[model samples]
Target: MTESLNSALGTISSVVWGPFVLIPLLLGTGLYLTIRLGGLQFRTLGRAMRHAFFDGDEEGNAGDISNYQALTTALAATVGTGNIVGVATAISVGGPGALFWIWVTGLLGMASKYTEAYLGVRYRVVDDKGNQLGGPQIYLKRGIPGGFGAALAFLFALFASIAAFGIGNLTQGNSVAAGMKDTFGVDPWITGVIMFVFTGATLLGGIQAIGKITSAFVPLMIVIYVVGGLVVLFLLADRLPAAIALIFTDAFTGTAAQGGFVGATIMLAVRFGVARGIFSNESGMGSAAIAAAAAKTSHPVRQGLVSMTQTFIDTLIVVSITGLTIVASGVWDQGADTAATMTSAAFTTALPGQWGGTIVSVSLIFFAFSTIIGWAYYGERSLVSLVGQWSSLPYRLLFTVVVFLSAITEIETAWLFSDIANGLMALPNLIGLLIMSGLVARETRAYLKFDPKLKKPKLSVEEFTAAQMPNWK
Candidate 1:
C-alpha cells in the first residue's frame, strides 16, 4: 500500500508539475499580472523594501507582526536547503543552464509574490476569537463568485498544512541531522533531541516569538552563508567566466561530457531549474502568503512589495551564489545527490579543503533550524484556519513529533509527497490570484494615486470581508 501510494503521488506530482501544466501556468500568470499591475513589482521593489523596514506604519497596524518580521519569517522558510541543496540538484541534473531558468522563475515570480501578499492582506479576516486569518484560501472563497472556489482554497490549505509537517518539518530535520552526522560525526538521535527541544521552545511561544527568532536568525544565517560562498567565488575568479558561459550555453545546446559530468540535455536543465526555483522562492505557493497575512501593514501593496523581496533574496541572490560556486568548482558532474553534500563538496573544492565543508555544514544547520521554526508557525496558522485556536497546542505537539521523526527517517518519500502537496497547494492559490487579479491591480492603482497626507481609504472591513468569505467558517 505504501508503495502504491508513493507511486500514485509520483504520478500526480509529475502531472501537476509538468511543463504543459505548471510552466505556462506560472510564467503566463506572472506575465499577465506584471502587465495588469503596470509592473508594480519592478517599479516599487526598492520602495517596498524601504516601507517594510523603515515605515513607521507598523506602529499603528492591526496585525500580529511587523512587515519586516513577516518578511523575515517567510524568508526563514524559503532560504533554506533549497538555496543550497536544491540549486546543486538542479545544476547537477539539469546542467549549468538550469541556473538561467532559475533566474527566469525568480524574476517572474516577484510579481506573483506581490499578488499573493497583496491579496493576503486585502482579504484577511478576523476569526470569532479576533485572531487574524488570511491567505489565498480566504481570498479564493471570498473573492470569487462561487462556492467551488472557496472549497478549492480550503482543500489547498489542508494539504499545505500537512505538507508543512513533511517538507517544512521532517525533511529539514533530516537534512540538518544528516549533514551534522556526516560532517561532525554527531549522532542523528542526539541532533534530533536537540532540535526537538529548540523547536518546542520556540513553537510554544507562537507567531510573535517565531517571528522574533526568525528575524534575528535569518539575517545572521544569510550573511554567514553568503560570505562563505563569496570567499569561494573570489578564489575561483579565473573560472567565473567559463562557469557563467556554461550556464547559458548548456541551457540550450546541452552540456557536453567533460570531466566527471555525464552531460545533460536542455530539457533536463530547464526542468530541474524551474522545479528547484519554485521550491526555493515559493512565490505562488501560498505559504508565504500565510506569513504575509500576519504583517502589520495598513497598505496591502506595501506588504506585497516587501514580500517580493523574499524571492529576490532567495533565488536571485543566494541560490545564484550556490549555483555559480558549484559550476565554478566543477563538482556538479560527479554522481552526487545534488544536496548539501554536493554543495559542501563544491565549496571544499573551491576553498581550502575541509574549511568549505565546515562552513556549509554549519550554515545548513542554522538555515534548517530557522526553517523549522518558520514552518511551524505556517502550519499552526493553517491549522488554526482549519480547526481553530483550541487545537493549536495539539497541532504544535504533532508538529514537534514530526520534526523528531524527520531526523531519523530516510526522507526521500516524504520529500516526494511534500512536493506533490506543494504543487496541489499552489493550484488554488493561482486560481485565486487569477480571479482576483483585477482587484490587486485596482488596489495598486488606488494606492499609487492616493495622496499619503489624505485619509487612507477605509480598507480594513473590505479586506476582512474578502478574506472571510463563505468558505472559512
Candidate 2:
C-alpha cells in the first residue's frame, strides 16, 4: 500500500509541478512582480546586502527577531539538500542546460522574494503580547480583499502545515540519518534518537532559540560549503569556461545524451531546473515570509530588503557553487548519480580523495539538521495559523516524533508529496503577492524616498495597511 501510494504521489507530483502550469505560474508571478517593483531587487542589491550582513542589530525594535536572525532562520530552512542533492539531481536529470534555467528562475525569484518579505512585515499581526505572526496566511486574508482572501489564506496554511511535515521534518530527518549512516556508520535509529533529543531541547526555547542557533549555524555552514566548493572549482579552473558554455548552449539547443545522462530537451531542462531552483531557494513559496515577519526592524522595506538576500545567497551563491562543482567535476554524465551520490562524487573527484565525500557527508548532516529545526518552527506557525496558539506544543511534539520516525525509516514518497504540497502553498501565496504588488510598491517608494513622516519608526500593521492601501479598512 505504501509503495502504491508513493507511485501515485510521484505521478500527481509531476502533474502538480509540470512545466505547463507550475513553471509559468511561478516565473510569471516573478516577472509580474519585477515589473511592478521596477527591478527593485536588482537596484537595491547593495542596501539589501548591508541590511542582511553588516547591519548591527536594531535597538528597541518592534518585531520578534533581529533582521539578520530572521534571514538566517529562513536560510536555514532553504539551504539544505535542495542546494546539494537537488542541484545534482536537476543537472543529472535535466542536463547542464538546467543550470541556466535555474539561474533564470533564481534571478526572477528575487523580486518575488522581496515582495513576500515586504508583505510579511506589512501585514504582520502584533498581538497584545507583541508576538508577531504573519505569512501568506495573514496577508492573504488581510492583504487580499473579500472572502477570496480568507479562503486562500486557509488553503495556504493547510498546505504549509502539510509541507512542514514532508519537506521539513521527514525529508530532512531522513537525509541526516542517511548522511550520518553513510559517513560515520552510525545506526539510523541512533541518529534519529539523538536528533530528536536535540530538537526537543531546542523547541522548548522557542523562536529565540531557533533564531540564535540558526543565525550561527546558517552562516558557518554556508561559508564552509562554499569554501570547499571553491577549492574544487579552482582545481578544475581549466574546464570552467567549457562547462559554462555547454550550460548556456544547451539551455537553448538541448543537451544530447552523453554518458549516462540520456539527454534533455529545453522543456525538460526548464521544468526540472525551475522546480528544483524554487525548491532550493523557496522564493515564491512564502515560507520565508513567516520568518521575515518576525524580524525586529522599524521599516517593512528594511526587513524586506534584508529578506531579499536569502534568494541571492541560497541560489545564486550556494546552489550555484554546488551546480558548478558538479559540472566542473564532470560527474553528471558519468552514469547515474542519486540524490547524494553526484554531489559526493563531484567533491571527491575534485579533491582526489575520500575527504570530498567526508565533507559532503558532514555538511549534508548539518544542512539537513538545520532544515529540520527551521521547518519545525515554520510548521508550528502554520499550525497555529490554522488552529490557534494552543496548537504550538502539539505540533512541535508531532514534528519531533516525525523526526524520529523519519530518521529510523526512509521517506522516499514524502519527497514527491512535499513537492505537491509546496506547489499548492505557492499558488495562494503568488495570488496574494499579485493582489498586493501595488501596496508593496507603494510602501517601498514611500520608504525609499525618505518620506519625512514615515522615516522615524515602523508602521503598525494597521497603519501600514492604511498607508499602503488607502481604499482598504
Q: Which TM-score value belongs to model 2?
A: 0.94
- Give the TM-score of each candidate: 0.92, 0.94
Candidate 1's displacement at residue 436, Å, is 0.8
Per-residue lDDT of 46 in model 2: 78
Best model number under TM-score: 2
lDDT per prediction?
A: 0.80, 0.84
Worst 10 residues of 1 by lDDT: 464-473
Name the runs in model 1 displaced over 4 angstroms. Answer: 1-9, 257-262, 451-473
In candidate 1, how many Å is residue 423 off?
0.5
Give the clash total for candidate 2.
0
Residues 1-473 of candidate 1: C-alpha lDDT, one tens digit per residue: 77887788778877777778776787778788888888876777776666665664465667888889999999999987778777876777677898999998898889899999888887788866676788876767777877887697788779778878766887789888878988899999999999899989888888889889988878989999999999999999999999999788888888776655677887777777777788889887888888898888766767788898899889878998899999898887875354548889888987775899899988888888888888887777777778778878898888887778888976566666767777778777877788889878876777666623223444652354245332422
In the range 26-95, model 2's lDDT, one tens digit per residue, is: 9999999898888987888877797677767666766788989999999999998888877887888888
Model 2 score (lDDT)? 0.84
C-alpha lDDT of candidate 1 relative to the true structure = 0.80
